[model samples]
Target: MPTTASMTRRLAIALTSVVAIFWFVALGLGVYVMQDEFTEIFDSGVQETAERLLIIVANNEARDASGRPVEAAVLAPALNSQYLTYQVRDSNGMVLYADGAQEPFAVPLSAGFSQTATHRIYTAATTDGTLFVQVADALDHRSEALMEGGTALLLPLLLLIPGSIAAIIFVVRGTLSPVAQLRDEIHTKDGGNLAPIDESALPKELRAIARSVNSLLARLKSALEAEREFTSNSAHELRTPIAGALAQTQRLLSEVPPAFHQRTAQIERALLHLGRLAEKLLQMSRAEAGIGISDERADLLPVLMVVVQDLERSPLGASRLNVKVEDGTALERSVRADAFAIVLRNLIENALIHSPPQSPVDVHIDINGIRVTNDSALIEPDVLVNLTKRFTRGPTEASGSGLGLAIVKRLVEQMHGQLLIASPARGMTQGFEVEIRL
Candidate 1:
């Protein structure tokens, strides 16, 4: 499963992209509107300057030295300049006055504003015959102004994108904090701790989740309690009858002759297997109840040595178990004694039953975990897959009730540990190995 940050990061990126796209579109529309308005203003400014020049020409009534009208240069600011350029021609197509840039404009004695290829031209007529006053401004000036205005409009949004991304990350993380809290709370929970969550301080969206989790915890707690009670009671009742039956069978065997000893031994084996099965059931019940899930730690090396000793004293156990430890006291600091005992006992017992006759079982303990190796024929892969299942027995002369591996697996899970079964141990290809990590 992906973390909340990864999931929300994609959402934030999508949101940021939406906002950025909107900014791009809005900026484009704004630039278009601004450019349109600027064109109107520029054209109006040119027209106003031309009208002013016309009024000046009309008011001054051109003359030379005497009271006679004649062609003359216009005012100081009106000739050959970048801002306002003008040309006036008479009805006869002769230049009466020209006060603008050095290049002359082609005119046909027309009137009003007209545009040429390179300039915006405004021509006007006086009261006299089709006389013209032409004012021109270049097209490149308008394009440059539009570009500058568009850049000004886009610059702010371009700069704001980085800040927007940062804000999005901050907001997304803050919004998902409650989810992180919920996950941490659930992660620490186990079978032993089924307490209800306090949803009062949580946000409304997460309160429902907290309540649902609390409901599940309450159900699990009840189920575990009921299961433990049933298993404990049933095991106790069966063990009493089973022990009495075994005693009776032993007494009957003594009374019978040597010819019936084989039949009595078969009966004794069945009773013993049943007793072992009942004991394993009780251990499984305690494991499910999390009876010893506490801080009390057990050093696995010494525990392994004790298990070896106990197995040697038992009839169904291997004759000898060779124990080896990397460090003796170095592994003393550990926890979950009950779980370690359950898994170790079952693994060692199972190994003893399957190991070749007179071959010593190997028990190796390290700082991390323990590995129990026994010399035995390899089990098939398909069959090995089901070895941990309940009532699954291996094909061997010395048989078992088949709940050993299953019980070990359950107890190991309760202790927050791992149980791994391997055939042929690591190097060789003829033995079996059971490894447990705490």
Candidate 2:
């Protein structure tokens, strides 16, 4: 099965990703700006050092014993490490003096600033242009500075990414909690539960949805109630007249001559069939009215036994039915006694009526559920699947209103139980079975 994506998860991920992307972009921009500023400051320092060394070397050049100028060198040693290294070169690009530099810089003697593969060099000249002072700063030093600065900015982000993700997920889930609640409320609505959703706790964005759902539920409830009422009233009104007509036809059969007896008997059988149909309609109406659920729990074993006994009183049911209740089992449930009775009657009656003559109908009750099986040829899969529909029957000539399984299925669903129908009943080669799980 394909999995559904959750709104909360999607929202959280989208928000977190956007936040992370923006943070990284901003960090990159910040590092770029910082590197530029650092370069400017280091270049100014190199230029200033070169200009000062030019003036100092011109005024304080070392003199030989004959009072002629010679090479001059200025060296400053500090306790801490030095960041700038420099060497002074004359106009011919000859090394005149050195400080912390190991060798002459790889550049022509020129004024202003220049760069090599390893260093940033600023060359300054005298008024006479006879000498030049070139100061060098190592490229690795600036790179180290930029790396440290970038690390400082990135460390906080490492901690922030996880925290932001958690915070985003938390907020998204909290914001969507009302939607989850609304979904649960809508899911609970069915034939048995059509109650309106509570809108007081919903956010403004979802309040309209709740109100619309409530309106729809109200309409459905009213329609179902009206339908049930009509069915119940019609069935109730027809019962007496049907019974009276049946009784009168039987009387006429006895009083009429032998030639007319067949017609009267046909009329009586028709009335009986009509009466049974009316009764089934009544049961269907009751089932639709959600009569299966109850707050009070009861021991349903006795109810099952009563229905079986009642069915067995008929000649057709005599010695053809068998029931087995597992040892240490209790049929305690929250279903109403009358509703359970109706379900049992319909199931057992369906089995008895549809199975082959003299074939045993078996009823088994266990801790898990109830099973009713009857010996018969395997019903087609297509027909079996629809056997629970109203007026749909298997390929049998047995007389049935076809509402028995339909009624059973409705009540079972209202009771929040499962009803499964199978051909070639469990452990049998050719039979039909209905199992109810509550």
Candidate 3:
């Protein structure tokens, strides 16, 4: 994409070129108009000079004894700018008087404004025989004067064109600086920060744009606040009843007979599933509120230990968990502590409930990320595609709330991380794996 500065400069140059071309065309038209007027004025001067000389030669007082006038001399001037030379001829084609040695035309031309190869001839009759006064002006002389006039008209514009382009560039750059600053400020904002953009110092055109952005930010903040409040209130409200039901079920388990024991245990599992679902709803609210978007980072080892201990106290503790971290790696590395702890608990708990008793779920922390693999999970490929979606559970018979991986995915995104799930996990012959990259 073209940038602001480059586009501005290109437009300036195009306009300048157009203006320059227009001026050049105007100058050419001016020169063409002057060309006809110049020829008329020069030819008039030649005719006037010829008429005066012809009168002098044709006057009766100037006639000599044989009715032929005596010859007279006309000298060439020193300046020689548009030098004019003339010759007079009698009726019988005899030269009466002449100035300069060369003749303008070899054969006699007719009367009144005759043009030869190089001269303008005037043939007149004045109470005697015919007389020709021919005056010739050099063609090169008129051409040189016209060239000098055209040069004087066009010289100054050469120096001004570059400076005009430079001024346009400087002005355009200054004009767009505010827009660039506004874009940078808006680009840095995320779900964690929805503050209004500054508009006090902006140009009038951009002030409206900033105002619109601030209005949008206001609406988004309100919506997120409402969502967080409802989730928190709902979690708190549901926890009370679900806890009461679980407590009643545990107490009833001791008093029940062997046949009733199985049914009571099923009731207890349903209550626990309801409790976990309520907890996951609260976690979703935290993710939306940017609680996991902290800059301070902590180690992964402590959070992993806590999550593993949490699973050990659950019904799925019958299975073994094997954790392996490469030496000198993943121990000192910083992780998003509170957010990742929740993610770890959800992942390991899901693996624990799905796996058979005495089977091991392996968790290995590497330099780049952490991977959890469970060989006991055997799900279809089509179902694996939607496993990260909300309210999705494994195919196993063990009861689940189905919000574990959903909450984990939401929190990971809040922390600017990635959660990838696959059945028949990478580098494994057969298993399910969840890879969390932060």
Candidate 4:
């Protein structure tokens, strides 16, 4: 029952969250890879500076002891901006010279040339008897650089979050506009309206949805028509029994006849009316349900003949009735028809009730279709449209329940056939027409 907009918005949010997680993971990996390069560059710069300094000291003129051998003041300035520590130590551990004003710096020695697991330590022995070691605190330096770069990228994305959300809201609303219109249209629609949704403004992706909705609406329209007809039929069929009971009651009330006589007469008349109504309704129900109809192919003309003849023997069919089958018509050729007999019966019965007494009813059958036309004035054109609806009746005439024509329509449609009604307008030439495919 959730609206389309809500569903779309949720999906957008979920996708955004996934993208954010992926971005974070990628950022972490990028920083890790770049960290190694930063360390390598820093180490190479320090080593080159150390090697240059060693060459300078080994090439310095070896003046007499009184001349101050390579004064520490001269060397101190050269090592000022570099990450190196140097010391000249004798074989007996006596410090001959050093860079800073302290004892020889304690340089942790490893077994051989190996990169210490620690962030910053590199050592090498110079030919001039000087120990050159480079020391740098790269862990803290790298942490600061990563923080700065991450902030720059993260700040922009954080700002974009609101825009992304707003975009999702806008897109969701725009994408669902047709559905909203459909909702409002349906909201105002009443039982009398069953028109389909218009899809001219819909996007291609949403066209399928609109088509589905239209199909559902079409089905609802048919169902509503059937329901209205059913109600009309019930009311029409109930009238006779109600009128009979009222008449019997009036007679008993006017004259104080014997108790048994009045009571028995009223009960019998009521029971008769009820029985007839029930029988007709049952027949209509069975026919509409397509019960007992076989799938075997049968000639439509022969079926119509049998039903018309049977109706002629009944009281309703005593009027002038005729059956005509087009000889050698292509419609007589065997077709796929399982409910031929029921179809014929319903059409004939409907024509008999509608036509006036002594008026001829024409039953025509051909290869393509069968049509029943009565001599009576046709029901109005609009009324014909709803004739197939359950419980519907003609505007002026009300005899049997209106379910008969409805049953015929349902049966015909179920067989993938069609039903059509046509008659002349506003003249004595008007007559009921019913057509059904084989």
TM-score of 1: 0.76
Q: lDDT tens string, model 1, 1-438?
A: 975648568867888899889988988998889878987897887777777777666655644435876444445465436655777666676665676554557645576677778888887677775456778888888888888988887888877787778888899889988888898888866765566787987899999999999999899889877876887788789899999999999999999999999999999999998798779878866776775354445556666667778888887564578877775435543346555677788898888878877778888887667888988889877877889898897767876777889888887776677888888688887788888876
lDDT of 3 at 69: 49
lDDT of 4 by residue, 166-280 (tens): 7777888777787777678666433334567677876787778778877887887687568646754765677666667767766665666576676767665666656556655
lDDT of 3 by residue, 46-74 (tens): 77776666666655335654677455433
Query: What is candidate 3's TM-score against the reference?
Result: 0.63
lDDT of 3: 0.73
Better of 1 and 4 by TM-score: 1
Evaluated with TM-score, which candidate comes out highest?
2
Candidate 4 lowest-lDDT run of ten: 109-118
lDDT of 1: 0.77
Q: Give the winner by lDDT: 2 or 3.
A: 2
Q: Model 4 lDDT vs. the true structure?
A: 0.61
> What residue pairs are clashing in model 2?
none
- Of the two candidates 2 and 3, the one with more favorable TM-score, higher being better, is 2
From the highest TM-score down, the ranking of the candidates is: 2, 1, 3, 4
Candidates in order, TM-scores: namely 0.76, 0.77, 0.63, 0.50
- After superposition, candidate 3 runs with Cα above 4 Å error: 1-175, 195-226, 256-266, 285-292, 295-305, 315-319, 325-337, 377-383, 392-395
lDDT values, one for every candidate:
0.77, 0.85, 0.73, 0.61
Regions more than 4 Å wrong, model 2:
1-4, 59-87, 92-111, 115-119, 138-144, 155-159, 174-182, 194-223, 281-299, 313-328, 334-338, 356-360, 375-386, 389-392, 422-432
| Candidate number with the higher lDDT (1 or 2) | 2
Q: RMSD, model 4, all Cα superposed?
A: 15.5
